[model samples]
Target: MSDHPFDVLAARALRVGAYLVRADDQGRLYDGIGLKPEHWRRAQTLLADAPEPWQKLLTSDPGDDRIILPNGGHILRLSSNRRGRHEHTILAVIEPCVCSKPLGQVLSESTEADSGCTNVTTPGQCNGCAAACLSDPITVECLLRCWYEDLFKLGRQESELTKLSQQLAETYEELNLLYRLGQELTVSGDPRCFVQSLCQDLLEVMSFRWVAVKLFDLPELSEQLAGMFVCEGTTQKTINEAEQAVEALAQMPQVHKPAVVLDIASQWGHLLPALGNSLLAYPLYKGETMYGLIVAIDKDPEAGDISSVDLKLVGSTASQLRIFLDNVTLYDQMHLMFLGTLEALTAAVDAKDRYTCGHSQRVALLSRQLAEALGLPPDRVERIHIAGLMHDVGKIGVPESVLCKAGKLTKEEYEIIKGHPEIGANIVKDIPHFDDIIPGVLYHHERYDGKGYPHGLAGEDIPMMGRLLALADSFDAMSSTRTYRAALPRERVLEEIQACAGSQFDPDLTPHFLSLDFSEYDGQVANHKAGDPGAQGVAA
Candidate 1:
């Protein structure tokens, strides 16, 4: 007896009419259990000529197969392995046959009506028929059909599993790409920056010779390109030539097609000499409005052929890009409209008094500079600028008699003047998108020692933006000529600001503010009342 456990088990099973056989690639049997020489020879011959139904079991890694012997006296269940230590082995169990005749003979002799043998007779009454026999051909045929159906169902299930796995893998890859794209693209508020980041992200996920985004003039598709953003793996000349070619192709009367992948050479053969041929063009649209076009030129050799999956990915990305671009456009329009309204308000404030004409604009310009000098962020600086322009908006509510009184005011008049900051804050407090600017508008007049303002916010207790604005507002007020006094000399103004740094201005911020060059603004302000369209100035 072999000491190997598998051999011992196989020997014991074979004695009970089951067997184990191992064969090599050459069809030569290598091991056997519980079989006479004659039986062993017969099994080899049978397997060598196994029917097509057994092909899957023989070729697959490890699985089961059932077969009826040619003589039809035995049915066998075979477990096969195409891998591991028993790589060439097929272990089988012999099951007693249901029919004496071969399966084929039984099937050939049976009819569909024979399948309903049980239903043909009443409960106790005997309906004599050949199908009622102990080894009925119909029963044998039905059993064989069921086994065959089970095998087919198993095969179909495996096929479906393979397809499902492939689809899942593709979905995972697509989601990963989208996640990366969102991280890279959504950080910028500028449309051009957004498009540039998009191009870079696409190149990371896919292989392309060049990627380009073209935004069109909206509400009208007549202009083919309003703006173009491109990232190129090839020469700029090649990209430029290809862009021109694509533009020309768009003008063709035959090119009224939807977004799709196309053979670049076939569509624009004349331009093939200057540009490589494989490309995809996708139109960006929302509803009936066509926004733009996104194009990829030449698939990278490493990326293989562009497939339906690639097209699907690109289309999904384009849809998201469309929404982002639309939002950016809308924001820009709203921003311009807001600026126009603020400019009109500033103009009205200037109209209240001739000497104070353009005072708000100067303050706004200086405040932005001071905010920058203090190392505030761009967004905060922009808020300060707007606040400076609107700081005196409450002056509109003040009686012109007091505004242009041309002499020192009584205590009550001075008290009313101080209320402008509170009134300015109240005026804009309800306007949407002005939340950050309101603090600066309300506290620009607040003294560093807590002595000034409609509110007594002082020292560090004042908002940082309020402190910066206070310095800017005071500097501009002292520099500009007024009905009561001529403008202070620059040196004298600087001396006074330095003298009052801790008392009236943020001492920590005053040095940085004083360090900035106001020469460019001084020149502009000097020319302001002489009639320039608008004062153009910048801080150094």
Candidate 2:
């Protein structure tokens, strides 16, 4: 038979064909097949004219025609027509290759070719039927083509799979970084640190070139947008470009509310060619109030020119970051409003009588110091500070006659004085974010040891902040000149605080209250106490 393509090509493809026809399919056989050699077209074309049933011979059932291969104990099958018979009479029998497998696999010994009968085709007899198949020329050509096509496809698939795996690894890394940034933003309380950390994460993980954040400053009744934070990549020069674009939009006589440059490439709307000419901005808003804008900048000018994938990522990430910014701004603003209302209430209380100006401010300072001394977390300390400032809020409801009385109050008047804590709690009860502080304000007068007034909460039952504030409120009251008494000396005030520990104050926090350094605030206290008569209540 003509030589197979396996005989002519590189060793790898030839080894693959050799392995596929092994006697028992053992080790080294498959490796031998993978190392098969390739043959040229000139060689393959000569074999294509041969007349073996090459397709059936290579892949058909072994039972039909079996040739026990020489020396090696493998059964190979080939079926062909018998020669010199009636024109085309077929004698189906297994036949082995006549040529030595020096170009294929090694054999132990030369074997006789299988024509039809076993006796005539013994190991010692004649040439194999491959001689007959080779002389015909059609069989060898078809088999060579089949093997080559399969190997090419397998190599291509392996290459593609490797690329897909690499891409998946990169995507996982990006998601992990985002998750970590989310955790940091959730735990962090400071807005500036939170935003700065977020920006750094976007630049490093998401590959954003430039990012900027702005906040609304209410100069009048209307909010004026101001850029509070901006971060740009080292490579990118378009810093604050988005802000300039928004500012330009605001200046146009045609648009009223702030205009967003959603797609910058378009000609009709706001355009700034300098700002990388590409923009994405999400409004930081809470209800009707516009807090600010978050802008993500890229250099691509045409919409089609920018990556749709990257743009989607920027939009989603910006939305999440915007929520965080809006939340923090709302929290800070509400805190300010709480302080403002507290001031108004304190002023109303002072308006009832001139004797206690800046009373709440003093209480607030002392309460904060005491809260710190107790090693409270900053969040709790903040709540305590607000509670201290607004503790006297209920006093706003007290009558002027009772507040300014110079002598000891009647039993009826003391009852009216005792109602302020409840009144203060009631006033701020409806305000969100003030609920935690309400207990401290309403219950500051309560005794830690169950001996004080109002609910007379005992021991740990009194809130730590309320207990701390109780000491501050009591000490400040004694230290200040009231309608009934002259101001007490610092030494006497410290002694009184020590005496009331565990009884009127949380014993654990009393030492901190006594240790407070009064020097820094002494002048401010004296100045506020020396209220200008002209400074009446603030306008509603």
Candidate 3:
């Protein structure tokens, strides 16, 4: 597990039993290849009892220079331990190291140790091998150089390992940053908030001195993003100054790809007052259209100058912003496309009853307001608004004679009027993506008291869309002029709605419906009247 190739070579080249010992405490032993525990303790005592010159050999640091000890012992320096004390790796002569027999056999046969052996030298006659194997230092100098060479290799390995560790850490940080960016990409709607968040996050991970994004020419983004500049991190510059830096980036004709500008004062001196010492910028563009720019100016001094990794990150983030803008553009186009078709169909229905010139548009707008007031989710509220535009499509099937009689309807003509809800429902059911609104169209005429129309679905049995649409439909119908009756005043309409709450409409939704601002509705009515001179008194 440890890196000690030099330790092995130092022992083999010297042909001595190597043991690691603390230079401060010469009596202690660590790694002794073939030496017994008692052999080490005996050898330590012998060195202690020997002449002061022998004791000095164990106490002093060998430090690349080889040291000789009693019984042909050799010592070399290894790096210091974590405790700051030098570990002297010694290759020493001992009883067990002189022969091939096990270390225990040699220690038991020793006769001049502990009691009578007081001097440093302790050699013994082996039963199977020679008494001593002292190393030839001068002869093995080249191999000893290999020991130093091996140590050099270890140093290089440690340096490389340290470098690799830092790279792996940086890679992990980049992955985490990308993961968070992915979350924002999928869920966020506000471009201003998204860009501001991106700047703050990049500042923390990339250690930039200042981070900022500038947006322009993106009509799909909400108007809130007009003249928007999002930034994070501290610099002497104000937001206007930051915007100037971004403007410089945008205006730079050569910056089509992600690139860095080093020595900002020298290379981009024009922007020096607004920027840091260096800059990394990535332009957000789609095809030939440029949308925005993301810039990071001057990295943290501790983080070093902006590197290639920083440039790549800025490029990737810019691409994401471009994607968000493209998505918004596509979605807006599809939304307008969807409304275009329904607008044409509603126009045909309006032509059959000239008095209700913009009745469908008004009902749709009013229903949208009521849906918002009732706290419906956006998707449902939007569907309700579109559904309101086609709610009276069945009126296209009724005879114009019955619709605009301008007189009391006979029994047969009135029944024909009552069948319009079913006709509207059938017509909408065949239209793609209009299935969700059929319940609303069919049951809009059904009353709360089980007395008023085709299905007579009373109270809670009615679908929620139907229940909601009922209030908007009746409110517009009663408030607007019809061939049979004049338009009611606001106060009279409000009182009639309040009185009919329990039987004609859902009592729960009546309050929220009554709370709507009719100013827009009044404006819509006035606009329709201006467009069609007789629209005010026609049947809606």
Candidate 4:
């Protein structure tokens, strides 16, 4: 065959593969790869017609090197390496050009010659190519093998790149779905509805075959978080199968251990009967405590689809779900703490005055009843109850001489006593835990008519919880006994509660507080201090 342009050039360079490089005039060295004056000579010959300096000349090197031509004209040196250890020998081998499938198929189908076919030389001769022109008989053989390895390696790398791209795309889509689901859960204040949405999202977004969420039962929680399962196909048979598997898992005793189990069928043969071929179970934990387990089962027909790497991804996803559940639990705990502290603070205030040992508690109980009667928001009602409980907490700073003087306090003493609202507000201001409740305690004493102390924020300007607490506090104070006077009659207390509606109490809240049975407060007060209005009062 007549020599082609690439073949002629490659022959002159004494190299096996086609490649090119740019020569550098400035000599420099890094290990054996360096620039020398001889490099510029070869480059000058290749581009003889070029301008002076020859800084950008394409060079013909009898060495292994690669050239990159940007925009098809500007050539540059990409890489170069030594091919021989002890001699001035180099072969410019370019990155393998992708071979056509026809070429590969031919090579794969060719039979080995009787001469052992130890190298590509024998195979080339069998294919009727000139054997003498090809360099060292063994060289041709080694080159053929090397090219074959490189071709397959390139194909594998391309495949891995495509796979990673697809996985990244899928991850982005799942993250978007997670964000939307979080929004829906937040807006869905109904616990059951939130959980239902969570279950559906876990199935639709995560592609889990079976998903179940269970919550830890606690005394403070009025509603028990039952098992919620979502699956593509969850019939009685499937559920029974799942239940049996759960029971079997339960038998594997782990003392408060939260764990993730993979390929669970291998460990529990019983799981095989009902479960998919692959199972991944993650335990939901709050702190170090395991609340429950979320199990994802996959029985896809393709075995290769669920690899160890895949199971790890599923486990990580389950951890995010666990975090959401933990946050819900935390929210509940915070709500409870808010209510409890408010109650304790109110009780502490009542304890300071012997005559009102049970007064604060009775008012709180009445305030809760009134809040419900007035159809107030549950969260608002909760704040009101807390405010009522701690409404007199500032009294903790009040001296007993003033509280139990058994006589009307002078204006100076009254003014000092009235500062309790601001003082109580400041006491809890530093506690970030009760952010919402502090406002109620601070403003509960303000009157609707703008006559109340500490910034007389009037009417609707007063926080609804504060207004509600003001009405409840007044009702309890009017009905209870004091050191200087006997308890007022129930009719008189009701008349006062109604007369002061728009002025002293929230008009809407006053009627609700007036509707309560005053006898109930008297009973609670007597019961609370019956043992020792003296010693028990001392404890208060």
Highest-TM-score candidate: 3
Ranking by TM-score: 3, 1, 4, 2
Say which prediction, candidate 3 or candidate 4, comes out ahead on TM-score: 3
Task: State each candidate's clash count.
Answer: 0, 31, 1, 2
lDDT tens digits, residue span 1-540, model 4: 122322223222212212223222332211111212343333333333323322322233634122332211112232222332212222232222222223333333232211122222221123323211222323333443354345446657878999999788767756765676667655215565665665566556556566555444543233434344333435225665666565455446541343444555576655445655555555555665555565556634443444444445445555666655656656767767866766666766777776877666766777777788888787677666666676677788888888877778899888888888888888867777566767667887899998997898899999887887787777666666677666676678778778888998788776667676656556666677774456232111
RMSD of 4: 16.6
List pairs with backbone clashes in candidate 1: none
Candidate 4 vs. true structure, TM-score: 0.53
After superposing candidate 3, which stretches have Cα over 4 Å from the reference?
1-212, 217-280, 295-305, 396-401, 429-435, 526-534, 537-540
Off by over 4 Å in 4: 1-144, 159-201, 218-280, 285-290, 297-310, 318-348, 361-382, 407-419, 422-439, 449-458, 488-496, 511-527, 530-540
Q: Write the per-residue lDDT of candidate 2 for residues 334-404, one digit (tens) a residue.
A: 76796788777776776676667777877888888777777888888888888888888888788878888
Question: Candidate 2: lDDT of 482?
Answer: 74
Among all windows of ten consecutive residues in candidate 1, which has the lowest summed lDDT?
A: 117-126
| Top lDDT prediction, candidate number | 3
Candidate 1 local Cα displacement, residue 396, angstroms: 2.5
TM-score of each candidate structure, all chains considered together: 0.59, 0.52, 0.63, 0.53
> Cα deviation in Å at residue 303, candidate 4?
12
Candidate 3's displacement at residue 323, Å, is 1.4
